[model samples]
Each structure stands twice: as structure tokens, then as C-alpha cells.
Target: MEDQPEHSVSNEKSTAVGERQLHRGDYGAETELQRHLSTRHVTMIALGSSIGMGLWLGSGKSLASGGPVGIFLGYILAGSMVWAVSHSIGELAVLYPLPSAFVQWTGKFVSPSAAFSLGWAYWFNYILTVANEIQVTSVVMGFWTDDLPNAAWITIFWAVVTLANVFGVKVFGEIEVVGASIKFGWIIVVIFSLIVTSAGGAPGHGPIGFRYWNSDPFTHGFKGFLSVMPTCIFAMAGSENCGLVAAETRNPRRSVPRAVGSIWLRLSLFYILGAMMVTINVDPHNKDLFGQSGTNASPFVIAYREARLPALAHMMNAVILISVVTTGTIYIYSGSRNILGLAHLGMAPKQFKHADDSGRPWPGLVLSIILGGGLAYLNVKNSSADVFSWLSNMTSLFTLFGWGMICLAHIRFRHAWHAQGRSDSDLPWKSWTYPYSAWWGLIWCMVLIVVEFYLAVWPLGLPPSAKNFFSNYVSVIAIVVLYLGARTYYRGPWWIKLTDIDLDANRRFYVDTEIEKVPEKGLRGKAEKVLGFLFN
Candidate 1:
């Protein structure tokens, strides 16, 4: 659905005003991006991005090491922290609705140097994520047959994703809507099927009611549980992408909050409960869960096979293949947008900022696809183990770093709001937890960083290796170098003062006033009523 103006000004005028406000600083004139994303688009994009390879494949790793109890608890802890971050971003996005979300906001509310560093680091993280997913696609395809080489599968999938993204935001939104629906529907089916099979309802299975947990709830021990935390965090890494797309969302004021609000449900149903079901259905010590079997070793697949449903197992693999491809597409979309945002901030070349008539940042998009797809070729050399491991380690750390910066930005934003004498009532959407929620997210991000570093130095099972340590902690070094280098070059304020923030810049004027909802009166009305919580 196209966004209708809530006030007298046309969409074009409102966009022009927003661009003018954003151009007030040294960043110069900002380009306007078309807001093509609808409520369903934003919501499904966030859902599709979050519920991908991490939950499908990485959960097997977590389950093997941490066991049933460890992963469950780890997900709880991580889910709480992620919700805090989501809420913080939702509030900020509703008010600011900037293209790059907190990456750019860090400059306005925190420090320009910080934004520069965070933007590049986070952009790199997405690029690696794209490659990682593509690599996994090879493994997923291998489940069927090795008729094609790994590189061939990689090339084919990469081409498909590039084409999908070439058509612009509407196509991206539609792809996500379809992909997320399939993923969501399959997960529900798998969860229910697991429950049934565990109850001896399947062809050849006896009741398996929490047998794994009863025998070995914590596989390795406390240390093993600690190892699961990072995986849990990675599972939900892209949850915040909803905020990044807010600027391109047709009605962010109404859609963004609803999308963010649903995150808690996504976490609860998808990860927490799904993890619980996996533990109940499959033993933690199941050797086929990981290792030599690869992505085909997902616990859900194992569960289906155990229930004597080989056909369904194959179907599940197909769904997972689609899920991985969709996620790679999202990472590419997000990476290109990040470049556009960097250009808007004058951190990247102006050429990268050029958007086609359809609002596609074609230059950045091509660069992102080339880099992401190019990196996937590392698998052909049989060196993906080393290359992708380093990439994984760096991306995971950057996820925490990005969240920390976002929380920090939200804190500064609240400070500016109060310092400027703006009432809480003026906020389009207020975070009920406010200071406490942002602090929770910020503190937990720091704690996870320390924990991840500790895990790197002395990994769960193996003796410490300098190589392993650096591989895990390398992103820290990268972030530091980027921050210091940008800090030196920009030579802006070391920190932005609360009163110095341009709070009014990029603020959506339409949201500040009340708008009436036009009630529908047919099948659409019933669907709207059913999904009412998805919009204001």
C-alpha cells in the first residue's frame, strides 16, 4: 500500500522538508529516497532476516555443545537483550526515520567519528554475512546431489539474488513477504510435527518426551552454556534491520513500531520455543547434528528422519535453501543502503549516493553484490574453513558492537530530548522503559563483548591458540582502527553534547499530529482486524 499523507503537504513536500532539515549540517544536501516499503514489507523483512541460517544451522552447534538447557537459557538472556535493543531502535526510528538508522544517528547524537567507524564496520559485517550465507547455500544444495560443484551452486545462487535486488524496493519487499511466509509456515509445521513425533504419533517413533534433557540437560557444563551465548546472539543479529528500512518505509510512524513490537513474539516463538522443541525431539549428543554432515544436519531434519519421514526431511531442506538465499538477499540490500547512508553523511564518495529513478542505489548495490559474491568463491579453494571462520568471528563481534552503539545513541537521544526541553508527549512513540531499557541493552552488549573475548582467548574445548584468539577478536582491532582513523580525519567533537544534537532534523512532522484511520468494510477489513496489532 502506498503511504498517504496525514497532513495537507504532499508526500513530495514532506520529503523535501526532511531532506532540507537533514542537510543543515556539514553533511551538505541529502538525497530523498522513495518510501516504498509497507507495513507487511518492513515486518516480514525483519522477520526473514532474523530467522535464517543462525537458527536453522547454527542452533545445531549450540545444541551439540551447550545441550538443551544451555541453549534455552542462552537464548533467554540474548532475547532479552535483543528486545531492549529493538525497543530502543523502534523509538528512535519512529522519531528520526533515517535511512541508516542508528549508524547515521550515532553521528548526530553521539559523535560523527563514531558514526563513520560504526558505519564501515557494520557495512563490512553485512558483506561478510552475505558471503557466509552463500557458502552455506552450497552445503544445503549438497544435501540433494553433488551434480554441481560448490562454486557452481554459489554462482547460480548469487546471480539469482543479484537479479532479485536489481528491480528495486518493491521487488525486495515482495520477495521478503513470500520468503518469510514460507519460512514462518514451515517452522510452525516443524514445531508441531516435532511435538507429535515426540509423543509417539509418527510411524516408527516411540515417545521421546524430553529424554535428552532428562539425561543430559547441560552437555559440556557451565562453560559450554557460555559458549552458546554468542550463537544465540548471532541468531537474532539482523533483527534491527527493520529500523534501517524505516526511511524507505511508506508509513514508518505507524509501521515501524508495530514491526518492532512483534520482535518479542518472533524471539519467543521462533528461537526460544523452537530451541526447546529441538531439545525435546533430538538428543544433544547426536553426532549427525553437525560436523561432517554439514547444513543437512539441522536438528529439525534429524527429528523428521527419526520419525520415519524422509520425504518431509527433503522438503525441509528445500525450505532451508530458500531461507538462506532470502537472507543473503537481505544482507545485500542492507549493505548497499548502508553505503548510501555513508554517502549521505559525506563519509563515502558522492558517486555512491546516486539513486536511480526507482530509488535503487545502483552503484552501491553492484559493489555489494560483487564483494559479497566474490568472497563466496573462497569455498572453491577448500580454504573456506579459515576464511569464513574469520568472517563469522568478525561479524558476530560487530553485531554486539552495533547494538552497543545503538543503545548509546538512544541514551544520548533521550538526553537531547530532555535537554532541549521537549516533552515526552512530543515523541511519536515513547519507549516505556526509557533510560532503563537503553541501559540494559548497553550494559549487556558490553558484558557480551567481554564474554566473547574470554571465549576467544580460551575456547570451550581446545587449548588457546593465538590464531583462534585473533580470529575472534580481530573485529575489535578493526573497529578501533577505523574509529581512531576517522576521529583523526574528521577531527569533530570527541563527543556530541546533549544540547548540540539536531533533534528536529529528519523528524517526521506527520506523526506529531493525530490522524484518523479509515475503516474498511469487506474481506480486507477482517484481515486488518485480525492483524491490527501489526499497525497503529
Candidate 2:
């Protein structure tokens, strides 16, 4: 690809010379992205990204390795940690409405070293995520036919998502909204089915009633718990896509917070409780999670099969396919947004920041396609199981690392806010449990990282599995190299101090919207009145 003049450092030099005369609260007056996503769009996007193939398929591994207590406790703790991270991100996104969203907060509030590692690390995470999603989708495709090569299916889906992204975020948001709503409802159905069937309502099992938990509850105790943390973390990877999309969300103060808050409900109801079903139903020592039964390795599918519901099992497999494809689309959008963020922050060539009139960042989209599509060919030699394992380790490690950086950045932001003598009243939204919550979240992140490291290098102080060691720590190696390289080139401070933090550069204070008038008592009122009474 030929480099264009618009992307040159010379171009940045000329553009930097023009002074923008702006008053207070006008720092982010204009953004290249269109804020077309409504509250429903943002909310569903978050749910869609979070409640996908991870829960449907990956939880099998979580249950197999960690057992009942481990899966339950791990998700509970990780869920709380992610909630804290999202809350911190919500506060920052509302205050500074810009492209690249929270990744830029690391530069302003934490350190440029962090921004460099986190910004590209997150991009890499999503790039690999897109590839993983496609490979998983192809695994699901095998349930029907292996006539089309895995690469063929990967290319087909990749092209579909890229076309939607090119059309712009409006198309992307609409597609995700519809997909998320269906998957969200389906998760509720699966949960209800699991409870009912486990109680002997489905004919094959007579009140299994947490038998798996009572018999072998904690598999291999804590060491086993540590081993599965990466898989559990992988299942929760895309939750942060919400904050990244805040740049294109309408009324981010409301949309982003609503999206962030919903994560708790999603995690508690879907992930944590879903783990409960797997632990109660599927054997903790089950080998299916490693795809012994192919992509239908989902314990949920196994549960359905056990309950004399082969059709239901197939239906759930279809849902997993749908979920993986939807996640694939979302990750493409997320990965492109990260590159766009990097370019805007001057870490990438300026050309990547260029968006079409439709508000699509063209070059960033191209880069995402290249990374995702190029990685898809890995499926040709290695099976989806091998590919998923390798990708999960990196994605999980970097995702947790990204979460840690978010908490660190927010801690610094809050410190500076207080140090500057600013009132919390000036904020659009305030998270509960201030400094304590941030620290609580951060401590857990460190715990997971340490546990993962121990599980990889020494299982109960035993020798490390050379394969697990490298697979699990690849992301850590990448981040260290990236941080050191960036620190060497742009060395300044190990940490950005509160007093020196730039809080004004992107202080986007939105004008309050007029409230909509209430509808008169009539057909509309009758419909809502009956619906409301039934709902109440």
C-alpha cells in the first residue's frame, strides 16, 4: 500500500500549526464519527458483545477445569472486577468524549507507556478475537457440512462484516441490536431450561440437584481454579467494547453508564448463573469442552442432549453459531476503532484517522480486515480447538491487562479531579465506592494475573508445561516489548502525576436535551396502561 500525503508527518506539522480557538467545555466540539447510536443501540451492543459464543461454548472449559465452586466464584469475582473497570471507564467516557475513548485516558491520567501498551494491546486482542470468532464459527459450521473449507467460511463472514463496517456504524449498530436481542432472550430461555430439566422435568435425569457440585465440587482445588481463570476471562472479553464505542454513542453520559451498569446484571444472571448449570449438570471431568464432540462442546448442548431433547441441542448449536457470527461483526468494529484511536493519539500514521464522509474510518477498517483475515488461515493446519486455546490465552491475558490499565487510569483521573479542587458535582456520573472500589478491582486483576502465571509456570509448584507457559504468557511478552519500546522512544515519567494530568483537552460538555411531552389518554395510553399494569 502506498503512503498518502494526508498521512505524512508533514501533514501533522501543518495541521498542528492551526490554533483552534475554543472556550471552556468545547474541547471535543467536532468528531469524525457520527453519534447515531441511541440508548437501546448502545445497551444491546454491550449485551451482544458480552453474551456471545463465550458463554455458549467457552464456559464448557471453565466448568471442566474449575469445577462448580471455582467456576462460580471465579465469574463472581471477575464480574465484580469488570464492573469496576466499566464504571471507571463510564466516568471517563462521559467526561471526555473522543475517539479511542478510554485508551487515551491512559495517556492523560496514567502514563504514555500505559497508553502505548494498552492501546495496541487492545487492538491486538480484538484482532485475534475476530480471528478466533471466525474459527469458532467454522467449527460450528462443521455440524452441517465440511464441504466448504474453514478458510472459505472465515472469508465469507469477514467480507460480510467488513462491508457493514464500510457502510458505517449505523448499519453495524442496527445489525448488532437485532442479533443481541435474540441472543439475550435465548440465554434466558437456556437458563430456565437448565433449571427445569435438572429438576427431572425433562424425563432423562431425576433431580440431579447440584450432584456434580456435592460430589466433586472443587476440581483439583485452587490449582485447577487458577488454570481455568484464563478460559473464564476469555468468556468475558468483549465487555469493554461498550466503552470503546462511546465515541459514536449518543448522550454518552446516559448511554455509556446504562451500558456499563447492565454488565453486572448480565454477568450475574448469564455468566455466573450459567456456570451454576454446567457445574450441576455436566461432569467436572468432562472432556467435551476440548471439542471432543466438535463445536457443540458447549455443556448447554450436552445438557439438552441428556434431557432427551436432541432437537433442542441442535437449536442451541444454531444459536451458538449465530452468537459467534454476531461477535465476529462486533470485534471487527471494535478492532477498527482501536486503530482509529491509535492514529488520533499520534501513535499510528495519521492516515488511519481519515474517515469517509459516511463517518467510517477507512484505513482503520482496512487494517482490522488485514489482521483478522490474515490470522484466519491458521485454521488450515491447526484445528479450531488449538486455535481457540492459543487465541484465548492471549485475549484473556491482554483483556485483563487492559482492565487493569482502565482502573489505573481512572484512579489517576479521580486523584487529579480532587487535587484540582474540583467538585464531584461537576461530573456527569459518579461511581459508588470511589477509591476503594478501584483498588478492589485492581487487586483482583493482579490476583488473576499472578494466579495465571503460577498455573502456567508451576502447577502446585510443579514444573511448567512448556506449551501452557508460552501460550498463556505470549500477551505478557508482547506488552513488555511494546511498553519498553514506546517508553524508550517517548520516555518521560513512569507515571503521570495527578497535578500534571490534562483534564481540559477533551472536556465535552453536551447541551441538555428537551424532554419529550407525555402522550394524551387514548389508544397509545390504553396500550401502555394495560402493558404497564400487566408488567407491574
* Window of ten residues with lowest summed lDDT in model 1: 14-23
Which structure among the candidates has the greatest lDDT? 1
**For model 2, how does the per-residue alpha-carbon lDDT over 1-536 read when each residue is reduced to its tens digit?**
24666568655544432111111222232557777776667777877786666677777766766778888887887788877887888788878767777677777777666787888999999888888887777777776788998888888877876776777888888788778867877878888998898888997778888788888877778877776777778888777778878888767876777787777767877788877887777886766665444444778888888888888888888888778878888888888778787776667787877777777877888888888878977988987776877898888889888888888888888889999999998887888767877888788888888777776687533567887688768888899999998777565557766776657777767656722232358864453343234222
Please tell me which predicted candidate would have the highest TM-score against the true structure.
1
Tens digits of per-residue lDDT for model 1, 272-389:
8888888998888777774424443778888888889999889988988888889999999999989888888878888988888898999889999999999888888864434544
Model 2 residue runs over 4 Å out of place are 1-30, 292-296, 459-467, 512-536
Find the 10 residues in a row with the least total lDDT in model 2. Answer: 18-27
Q: Which residue pairs does candidate 1 place in steric collision?
A: none
Provide the overall lDDT of each model, using Cα atoms, as 2-decimal numbers: 0.81, 0.76
CA lDDT of 292 in candidate 1? 28
Model 1 scores a TM of: 0.91
